[model samples]
Target chain A: MSQEPAVIDVPFEPHGLPPSVAGAAATTVSVSVTDLRNLRYDWVASAIPGRLLDAPLPIHSSFYETYHETPIKAANDVPRTIADALRGQLAAQGYRIGPDHADIRIGVIRFHEDIPSAQTMNNCFYNLIPETVSVVAIAAALVEVVDASDRPVFVKYYHAAHKVTPWCSPGQPIWAPSLLSLYRTNLIAAMRDMVGQIIGDSHFQEALAKGGRP
Target chain B: MKGAVIALAACALLTACGSIRFAVPYPSVGTPARTPGAANEIVNVVAKDDRTDPGGAVGRNGWQTLVPSNDPAGALAGGMRAELAARGYTVAPGHAQATLDLVSFAVDFLPNDLPLQASPGAPGGTVIATVGIIVIVRDPVARPVFAHYLQVHAAKPYYFNTSNAPDARTVLSEAMQSAITGMIADPAFQQAARRAQ
Candidate 1:
C-alpha cells in the first residue's frame, strides 16, 4: 500500500497558432521533444557477478547455463534513438525543432523490451534444450497541441509495437559476442518502426488540421 | 539416458502448463464505514489486461506463478464490485454515473540464488514477485479524476529445498488484493465517489 497518488502537470509557453492552419487546416506546425523515458527494468545490472558461484545454482547440473550477460543495449540508449527518429520524421514533415514557440510538444511515455525467463531457454536444464524467446517491445508517445494562449487544443496518444522470436538451442552460446549486437539491432528497428507509426497517425494529422483549443 | 529422457519430458510437460485458480481471500467483506449513504449509487466497472498470457506465467522453475484466475480482469472487477457492494455502492453493468477501469496489469518474478552454507547475513534462495496495476476512474461527465499506477512486490527465501517455498500465485494474488484495497480505501477516492453519487 505504498503507492502514491497521480499528479500530472505540464508547463507550456504561449505561442500563436501555426502558419498553416487558419480556418480549418494548419499549413505548418512547430514541435519540440520534451522528454524521452526509458521504462525497462533490469535486475542483473546491480547484481554482483561471480558471487553466484558461491551459492547453489537453482537447478543442479554440471554444465553451466549461459545467460545473456550483456544488458539490452537498445533499452539503455532509447532516449537517443527516440530523439533521432523524432527529429528526422518531424523535419521531413516540415516541423521546426527547438524553442521557436512550438505549437506541439512530444514526449515518449513508454519504451521497453520484455523477455521473461519462462519464455527463454534459460529454463532448460544445463542449456541442453532449445527454446524460442519472444521479445515484446511497446512504444507510446504523448502529443499536445497548444494555442497562443498556451491552452491545449488537442491531446493524443500514439502507440506502436514490435515482436520477434529468437531461438536458443543447445549448441548456441547465450553470451556470444554478437548476441548484444543482435538485440541492439532488433530494438532500434522496433523503436524506429513505432516512431513512424506515431508520426503518421491519421488522428495526429487531424489534430494538426483542426488546430484550436479543446 | 532413460532418466534424462524422463526428466526432459517432465520439464516439457511442466513448461506447457495450465492455469492457476485464485480464490477470493475474504468474502462478504463489509463496506467502508466512513462512506455512508453510498450504497444506492451505481458505478460501472471495466477491466482489461495486456500480458503475453492472461492465465499467468510459468516460471523458469516450471512453477505456475501469478495466475489471477482463468480471467484476471473479470475476476479483479468482480472482486472490486464485491468490495463496493460491501461498502454500500451499487455496481451496475452499464450507463452508470461513474466508471472504474482496470486498464493494465503486469506480473514479474525475480529469481534469487544464495549460498548453501549458511553464514551471517548470507542471502538464501529467495524469489521475489512483483505485480503492477494501472487504474483509472472517470466521473459522470467522463473526466478522469483519479489515475494511479502502482506496484506491489513480495519475496520469500527458500532453504535447501524450494518445496517449502510459498506458491507464487498465492503471493502475487495477496499483493494484488492489498493494492486494490489501498486504492478503494483512499479518503480522496471516497470523497470523489460520494460527490459523483
Candidate 2:
C-alpha cells in the first residue's frame, strides 16, 4: 500500500483587487511582500462522523475527505496568491512594487482555507434524523510589516467565514452541486474577505508611509 | 454472534489506542534587528513545560487524540533559543539575565455557532491554540529587573470529521510563534533584556 503524502499542495486563485480607498490617489512608497507560510503541513481534510446504517445514528467513526482528490490547475500559485493580491492592490493605490531595496516589507504568516462541516436535520427524513450536512468556508491569515532595518513595525490577524451550502441530505440527488465546486466557491469568497481586511487597514497604510524613514 | 461483537469492539479499541502525533517545526522569526544593544547581551535561557498534563493531548477528533510528536516545552525553548540567537543575543547557561517559562501550551476545539443541531456527525467548531509564558530578566545578582506574563491565541476552523492533524499542527505552530514574537516585541521585555548585566 502506498503511504499518503504528508502535505498536499492545493492550488488557489484569489479574485480581483480588494476594495481600495475610493478616489484615493496613488503614492510613490515602494514595498515588497514575502510568503512566510509554514510549508510542512498542507492538506487539512474535512471530517464527519459516520452514520450507522442499522441504528441510523451518528457514531464515533469519522469519514474524512479532502477538498480535492488530486491537485487542480490553479489560476494563481498557492502561497503566492495572497502576496500577489496585496501587490496588485498596492499597485492600484499607486505604490511601487519593488522587491530589491523596498521601503516597507510585509510577510504573510498564514494563508489558508478551512472547510467546516456540521450535521443538521435533513428534510428527507422528515427532520427526524440529524444526518444532513452543512459546510462553510473559513479563511485566515497573520501578516506582519517591517521597515528597511527589518524592525517589526506592525502585525495583524485577519479572518473571514461564510456558509457554502445549507444542510445537504445524505445521498442527495446527482443534480446537486459537486463538493469540489462548493469548496472552490467558499475558498474564493473567504480569500477576498480576508485580503480586503488587510488592504483596508489604516495602520498598514501608515506603516507603508513611514517605512525607511530616518 | 456474541463473539463477533466482542471481536469488533476489540478492533475499535485498538484503533483508538494511540494518538495522532505531528511535529511542530521551529517557527520562523521575521526581522531580528530590534534593539541595537541586543547583540551584545548574554541571555541565560531556561524553558520548561509546566502544564499539568504534558501527555500532549491537545485536542480530539471523534475518538482520536491529537498530540505533538516532541515535548512542547522543549520545542518552545528550542524555538526561543534560535529566535534570540538570530537577534544576536548570546544564549547560554550560568549568570543569565533572562529566563522564559512555558506555562501552558494547549489547543481546544470549540464548536462553531451554527444553526444546526449539535451531534457527532455535525461537529463543526473552531480550534483555538493558546500559549502562555512568563519572561523574567534579572540583574547580575539574580535580582528581578522585569517580569511579565504573556499569552497569545491563534484560532482555526474545525470541521467535525474533516479537520485532521495538519489543522491542529498549524494552529499550535502559530500559537507558539506568536508567543515568542509577542515577548520579543514588548518594549518592557526589550528594556529589561538590554539592562540585564
Candidate 3:
C-alpha cells in the first residue's frame, strides 16, 4: 500500500497567516477563491498578508450523489456557484483601484462541517443557532501565498454549524442571500480586518527587504 | 441464607466486570489495531480524527465559530478494524488470555466562552467545540487497560464581520479535520499502546 508522507512541522518559519484565507497581502496580487458548495458571503479578500481574489473552482457535479444516493452533478455545486457569483461582485465593484506598488494578491480557502449538532437545537442557549439548523457541518482549509517568499500557502480551517441557509428545506438548494445576508455582512467586515493584518505584516517584511522602511 | 450469599457474590462479580457507558450512539466508521507481540493489549479505536479549514473568527451573527463534532462511534469501530487488519490481526470473539474491549467513548461540545484575545460583548459568544474522545479499554478481567482524555483545540482566524458570513461547510470541515488530525498526532495515544510488557 502506498502511504502518504508523514506530517511534520516547518520550524524555520516563524509567523503564520490566518488559516481560513487564500493568501496574505505583502504587495498587490491577484488570487482566486472557489466555493463550490455555494456559500452566501463569498470569501476572497485582501488581508494584511495577501489578497485572495476570484479564481475558477474545480467543482465537478459528477464527484457526488445526493444525500439519498441519487446521482447529482456537483461535488459541491452551491459553494462553487457562489464563488463565481463573488467574482462577478468584485469586478462590478471596480476593484482595480489603488496603488500599483501597494500590496495586491489573491488567496482561496474552503471550509466544511462534518456533522450538524441536532441535540443542541433542542436545548435553548443564548448564542445557539435556530432549530431548522440542518447541522451544515463543514470542513475548511485555506490556500495562500507566503508574502515574504512568494511561496504557496495551504492550511486547514474548521467549524460546526446547525444552520446554513434560512429557507429551511431538505432539498431547497441551500446557499441563499436571503438566509445569509446577515452572515455575509459580518464576514465582509472581518475580511477587512484580517486583510489589514496580513497586509501590515507584509509591509513589515518588504521594509526589511528594501534595507528598512523609508 | 444461601440466597443472600449468592446475591452478594453476584454483586461482587458485576463490580469486577467494570463500567461501560455510551453517551450517545451515532453511526460512522473507524480503524483499530493491536501492536505485534502484545496479545494482552488491544487498542480499539472508534474514529480517527479528520483535518481543517478557515471560517468563523466569530460565527455568522456573532455565533462562536469553530465548534467540533461529537464522536462518530461506528466510524471509530470500523477504523479500528481496518487498522488492525492492515497490521495483520485475527478479529472475532476469541480468548487470547488477555483482551482489549472498547467499554465506552464520549465526545462533547461545551461553551468555553474563552477568548482568543478579548473584545467587549464578546460574551465572548458560544464556542462550538469538541473535547477529544474518552476511550476506556478493559483487560480480560474487565479492568481498565487504558483510559484516555483529550480536547481538540481548533485554531483559525474568523473575525466577526457582519458584512460576510462564513460558509457553514467550510467552517465545519476545517474544524473536523483539525480535531481529527490532532487526535492521531497525540503522543498520549502512542504511549498508551506502546507494547505493555
Off by over 4 Å in 1: A1-70, A73-110, A116-127, A140-161, A193-214, B1-33, B36-41, B52-69, B93-124, B139-146, B158-166, B185-197
- Model 2 chain B scores worst on lDDT over the 10 consecutive residues at B1-10
How would you encode candidate 3's per-residue C-alpha lDDT over B1-197 as one tens digit per residue?
Answer: 22223323433433321222222222222443534533443444443333222111212221222222333434444544444444454433322111212211212122222222223322322223222333433334433334333333232333322211233333333444444344434454434444221
Instruction: Pick out the ten consecutive residues of candidate 1 chain B with the lowest summed lDDT.
Output: B112-121
Error of 2 at A139 (Å): 3.0
Residue-level lDDT of model 1, residues B1-197, one tens digit each, is 22234335543543433344443232124445635756666766676654434454423332333344456556666676777777777777432433333323443333343121323234334554444444555566544444444445555554322222234455546655766677677776666565554
Which stretches of candidate 3 lie above 4 Å from their native place?
A1-28, A36-141, A146-184, A193-197, A200-214, B1-197
Q: Among all windows of ten consecutive residues in candidate 2 chain A, which has the lowest summed lDDT?
A: A49-58
lDDT of 1 by residue, A72-188 (tens): 322234444566655556555655444323366666555544544422344442454444455555555555665555644555555555666654444565455454444444445
Report, to 2 decimal places, the DockQ of model 1: 0.16
User: What digit string (tens of lDDT, one per residue) describes model 3 on residues A1-214?
Assistant: 2222111111111133323222222223333454322222332211100011111122122211111111111122333433343333323323222232222222223232222222222121222223434223222222232223432122212222223433344333333333233333333333333333333454333422232111
How close to the true structure is residue A152 of candidate 1, measured as C-alpha lDDT? 49
Q: Which stretches of candidate 2 lie over 4 Å from their true place?
A: A1-41, A44-76, A99-106, A116-128, A131-133, A165-167, A173-177, A212-214, B1-59, B63-197
Residue-level lDDT of model 2, residues B51-151, one tens digit each, is 43466466555335677777777777778878888877777765456666665565655544422233334546666676766666666766556665666
Chain A TM-scores for all candidates read: 0.60, 0.62, 0.29
lDDT of 1 at B23: 38
Itemize residue pairs with steric clashes in candidate 2: A45-B162, A46-B162, A47-B161, A47-B162, A48-B161, A119-B122, B112-B125
Better of 1 and 2 by TM-score: 1
